[model samples]
Target: MPEMGRLPAGTMGLAFEEAIRRLELRNRLAALFERWGYLPAATPIVDFYDVYREWVNPQHVYRFTDREGDLVVLRSDATLFLARLLGLQLSEISQPLRLWYAEETISHIPSNHPVGDTGFQAGAEYIGLPQGEADWEVIILASEALECLGLQDYRIHLGSRALARVLIEAEGQTWSKDLIRDIHRLSGPCWENLSANLRHQFQCIGEPDQIAQQLGPFASCPEAAFLLQSCDILRSAGLGERLVIDLNEVGLLSYYTGLVFKIYVPGYHEAVVSGGRYDGLLKKFGIEAPSVGFSLQQGLIEVLHGSPEPQAPPAAASGTSWLERLANARRRRAKGERVVL
Candidate 1:
């Protein structure tokens, strides 16, 4: 039997100081996102399993039959639920919805997985805008969010599913999830048998100009053209040194139809943020709007930021009554200061 007070296998509990730091980090990111005009949004923690069964692997979802005899799942992916919610309820809203969410997602993981199943994600979604500016905005916002978190040395690994698809078709090989994953990891037994040109294409990674030169004839492809344009835009916006165009790193999500990216910090081996364009994801829920977004892994951020020192409450106002002190504390809090009554 499990120990009485022990948490579940893939769950974790944060103590007071760590929890407070996490809350502060969320608040900082929230302020940054709000400044960029993203309104807060949320979805139910429990949702119909049928909605996501097609996109998600069954083994990775925590599902059970509800009282209504319908299978349901603890939210495994926030973007999936948001796509359904926006499609079903807010479809008639004006075009180009800018929304953000900070929610906990629970999923089942194999024993070897590094992190727990329950994860907190803070993200922003830009829907309805066409690929160009929308892509630039989210990618830049992601960089700003990292800066807000005091992470100065980081890099964004940018890739495009569209470009990958075009390249695969050119080589006469059909694209599959397994193939994409293998390419992303640069592994698998099939790697030895791939054509030399295909192998060289996958090896193409560097600054935008270097990638364009290496792409040779493939650079003229529409998808590749868009990607190069995006790189130029990002460079113009002062992200030139930080951007790395890596064609081999295609998106992990099945719905990603355009550019995909992952942000990495120095000490971390996994991505701190993962997202990209999923123009077709909304169509799965009966809406047909272009969409792109990125989700920041709060746990990973916390690990990178380390445990923050507990804030000391403001000093008590001298010669003030209890009521006056309370009022002053309230005012300080309103101005975003830590206070204790």
Candidate 2:
């Protein structure tokens, strides 16, 4: 039998100092999001499994029968839940909604990494904005968030789903999940069979201007044109050196209809942040609007940055009597100095 107090394989328990640091980090991120005009949004931790049945893989989520005999699941994806919620209230809310959330999502899949199934995500969603404007805003926000965490050595791998489709169609090949996966892997037999030009296109990864010059023939296509335009926008905003244009780096989600990106810091195997523009996702809930967002894994961030320095407790109030000490403590607290009696 397992030890009495043992936690599950993919779960985590934080000690006092680490827990305090986590709270501090969450508050700092919340303040950053608020300063950017993103209001906090939350959803139920559990929902009917049917809601996400079509979008997520069964092996990736945790589900069980509820007290009422209905299949329910612990929330696996914050964006999906937020999209479903916003879709139901689209008529009730104003356009260009900016919402942020900090929550923990649990998954069934086990992982060897320190950041496992129960991941804490801090993210923001921009709803009802067109492609270029919305994508630019979210990408800049993501970059700023990394800077807030003191992560200077990071690269944002940018790509476009539409551009991927265009490239595949241009080569007289049908766009399928398998082909996209193979291209992303970049070393499979399917990748080897690809034409030299297409393989070169997938291999092209560099700064925006370099990529634009390299793929001059494909630049005229609408998808590639828009991607380069967005690149120019980011370059103008002083994020040129931080970008890596990878045409094969399409997002993991099928809902992504346009720009997709992942932020990677040096020495980390997994992306610290990932998201994209998913224009068609909200439509599934009967709302028609474009949405873009990104989520950062807080656990991975804590590991990267290390625990913050712990604050020293305030000195205890001195008094002869218990009542006097209590009064002194209250006075110090009122003056904004934390005191113990």
Candidate 3:
């Protein structure tokens, strides 16, 4: 029998200092989003299993049957749940809907990942906007969020779902959905019979424009063309230095229909933030509109930000009366500071 009161594997409990730092990161990111006009929103922790299965692997979700005998799951992904919550309402709404969320997510995490089964996530979604301004805005906001969290030395790897598709087709190779799913992972089978030049291109990372130019004939594909255009626009907007072209970074979600990207910093093997445009996702819910967004995982941010410094304890009261000491402590606590009697 399983041990009682023992937390499951791949899960953790954050203590005082770690919990405080996590909250501080969340509040700062949320404040940044609000400053950009992305209003706050939330979704239920538990949602219909079907709502996520299309985008998330079934094994990665915590599933159970509801009282009605229908399938339900603890939310493994916030984007899908948020999409389901706002799909119908957004159909009648105008374009350029901006929203942000900070919440906890639960899932069956991989054994090798150095994180718990549950984690705090903070992110923003830009809905109803197309590639040009919306894409640039999201990238800028991502970099800005990292900087606000005191992460200055970070890299953003910009990939293209469109370009990846074109590259596969250009190789005259047919890939099953399962194969495409495993292509970027370590356990996946390698693509055999590929040319040396093709293999090199797959591993290539450089300026977006340089990669686009090197594509030569494959540049004619519509997806490649769109990627080239967007890259140019993003560079012209002054994000050129922080950005790099990475064709091999596939998104976890199959619905990522356009540009996809991830943010990495020193010392972390996994991405700190991941987001992209999914113009096709809203339509999956019967709502036809373009959408883009990014999520910053607090676990990774804490890794980069390190532990919070201990605050100095409140000075001892002198000859003040008991009532005065109590009132003084109350005043300090009211202003969101720690206090001691």
Q: Indicate which candidate wins on TM-score.
A: 2
- Candidate 3's C-alpha lDDT? 0.79
- Residue 325 in candidate 1, Cα distance off native in Å: 9.0
Candidates sorted by lDDT, best first: 1, 2, 3
Q: Give the higher-lDDT candidate: 2 or 3.
A: 2
lDDT of model 3, residue 161: 78
lDDT of 3 by residue, 1-341 (tens): 56777887877778877877777888888899999999998989998888777778888889999999999999877888888888756664465789999888998978887787987788889998877688879988988998999988888888887777777767787645564565565234544445566666666678766787677787777777777677677777776667787876667677787888898888888899999999888788878788999988877788766667875666653337888988887877888866677
Computed on alpha carbons, the lDDT of every model, listed in order, comes to 0.86, 0.85, 0.79
Q: How would you order the candidates by TM-score, starting with the best?
A: 2, 1, 3
- Which parts of model 2 are misplaced by more than 4 Å? 1-3, 92-94, 187-193
Expressed as tens digits, the lDDT of each residue in 89-204 for candidate 1 is 86554578899998898999787988789889989999998798999999999999889988889888889999988888887887887787678777775555567888788877
| Residue 25 lDDT in candidate 2 | 83
What is the Cα-based lDDT of residue 140 in candidate 2? 93
